[model samples]
Target: MKKTCVHLMLLVVVFCLTTIVQNRAFSELDEGLGKSLKQDSVDVWEDFLNTLDRRGLSDPHWELESEDKEKLINYFKAKIAASVSEGLTSLPERLPSYVHRFPEGMLQTLKSHAENVLKVNPHNGAAAKFLAVEAFHKVNTQISSEKYPLLEKAMVLAPNDIEICFFAYAACTRLGDQTREEALVALERMLERLRGGDHKVSYLWTVRLYTSEVAATPVQIYLKINKKHPIIDRWEVVLTEILAVFENELLQTPDSGVFNIIAYIYEAVGDIAAAQAVFKNLKPFYEKRLAENPKDRTALTSLANIHNKLGNTDLAHEYSVKVNPTLAWEGQVLPEFSPVVDLDGKPVSLADYRGELVLLDFWATWCGPCIVEMPNVKAVYEKYRDQGFEIIGISLDTDEAALRKFIKENQLPWRQVFDGKRWEGPLAQQYGVRSIPAQFLIDREGRVISVKARGKRLNALVEAEIGDTID
Candidate 1:
């Protein structure tokens, strides 16, 4: 009995000791892990808020003045530091609420701020489109060309997002190309939900997207009849709200922002004249801003782009010169594109073959059609070698090594240039090359009479031009 009691006591002591050690170790480990997580959360939160702070959104740009801008700006710094003390899994929900709690004007500004430097990090594969569009709507115009590209990527990344696609619609119209098919798909989804009773903002936008050229009749009818109706006039309320949003910001300022959105809306609604008048007024303002800040390359570039789009070549060229004096335009009388040497550092010019009939063929290594007909090109060149015909081949091969290998293997008996820049030489831009396999059959005088000739027909056609062919 005494031995059994002693053994039982021994077991009880071992169990108590083991339990104590485990609980103490676990407590220490939990404390350490909690500290580590707190540090990580603080770092991420601070980084996220810093991005917004840089854009002047944390304190709100709309309400800034000589009095409180500095204090508010500093507060963004302080608040960002404070936010790091929170948990990560709670951030997404917390962030939206935090934004909502911001001063009325700050929400829009924050949205804009968030867009410029989206949550790009080690894991972010794309810009946050939903965040960007929410911010973009608050601004008067696009800040950069990159925004359009970002919105496009966002639409692809989140195809079901309707609000993101709405901004995408505006971006496609502004930027041109690449998003048409995808944008159409998203618009159809939005259209399925839209009713004429939803309001003019939703319905009119649907009409613009669905109807290639929106008829003026329905818009005129909407304007005349819907001004008094509550649901339909909600669009007017939105316009009013936008005005309020920009009013304080542009108040007593020389910003033609109010007019710009009105014009954009008018243009979107098929009212060309209204859009034109507003755009015309704003154009001068933008141009004047460029004049005031001669070093504002962005402002100058935008003006030049607009002019170029409008077919005002001379004005466009003039403004483009302000941003970059050397970048040549494509559609011009002089050569705008020239081939660089891929290997052997070769250089050929139109002046080199002044007396010879030059068949300047723009070819490429990646161009399948160009490759398929290269043998024929070689045969023609060989036949015309002694006939005062200079077949100067320009390979638009982007890769120097690839071009050289192709040339070496083929044993092409022709002088060629393969320095892979495109549509930027004096001769190329003059000729207006829009497609591959484009050839300029120039006479001995260096005057091109025909272009876009290919295959055996190109050789015969060139020969006929030089009075060398029987036909």
Candidate 2:
């Protein structure tokens, strides 16, 4: 009775918000290591019975007397009946010592339980994150929640879910803040923070995660750091790839988390066409979803975004008229008028870079391919310095010092910008850069001549028009 009392008390306290995914809709169920063990298995004894099948693994699961098992199950049943969410914070006290027997395997089992039963079963993405917290203590390596596939899926399934997004941010921080990982996590957090007052969250992570996708992180830390610029050819290829990602995501899963990132990627690479496509595709989904559930805040805000994209001033203003409804469809909408930021801590204005050959290049330090063509770009800048070639290199680098040092070392001889804000950087989203080494070639007339072009390679195209080589 004492043991059961302790077990039950622990069960009642810990919980994460959960949702129930319709099982029938999901087709056949998976039962790797007891995750898919039926509801009966949630009870201690039945769970123990299943555990008995592989008694060697019983250390992770309970190995108790029949009576004790019955008591723990009863406690769990009461806890579930009250609310199936208050998940067990930890296994029953005095779990078999041998649990340490298969440390790695046991950790995997707990993770599965967290992902499958806690998160997916009820469709409660929030609850599933708790599983991650538990896994954090169990392992040596810090697991970035952004990189975790489960968190990614949860964000995808529930883009408007704030708690889940917060959980993802926490997870990314736990994962050691690796640039891409930090940016991925930061991207989600940034969108949510930007939308705190109003709106739909962009919900994609890697694209906006600030570690500057276009520029390279220095190989060495200080002034002695080895630096190399990206290969423009690769940038051309990757820019197309990022645009392709945006276009393809819209066509296939329109209004998805990844689509938003692709849109940002497009802008980062200066592929406005591809970026606009994202808003265009999202428009119908938001409108349709709103039509089905006009009360849905996420849907309403998304519709507002479409209006914002189309420059539909009147329609965009109309969505601001909020009326509360019980069941909403998407992200919560706050007040509008959030301005995008440039990396230099300055607000970007479209009117400023007019009448010049503007090359908005987005890159990261970690991108092996992006750094290969920097020399070519440097050459282009030198060749056309007197002529009219303008290169605005926007490093996706989150580290202000490193970004500055990178420019200094490469002797870029161009205006550079970055907020050290990773994926959430204003310019990145304004341009929509998903991958590294993305360059947009803009002509003097202020019209976008090409979405995908290399810094050095496109210069030649421009030179041909002068009727001779720059040399």
Best-performing candidate as measured by lDDT: 1
Candidate 1, 18: how far from true, in Å?
34
Clashes of 1: 11
Candidate 2 ranges with C-alpha deviation above 4 Å: 1-348, 465-470
167-196, model 1: which lDDT tens digit per residue?
Answer: 555444443334333334444444433423
lDDT string, candidate 2, 291-385, tens digits: 89868877766666667767886677567444222112112221111364454566554356666566667776766777887777777767776
Candidate 1: misplaced stretches above 4 Å? 1-44, 47-249, 252-262, 293-295, 304-342, 351-471
Which candidate number has the best TM-score? 1
What is the alpha-carbon lDDT of model 1 when measured against the actual structure?
0.52
In candidate 1, what residue range of length 10 has the lowest lDDT sum?
81-90
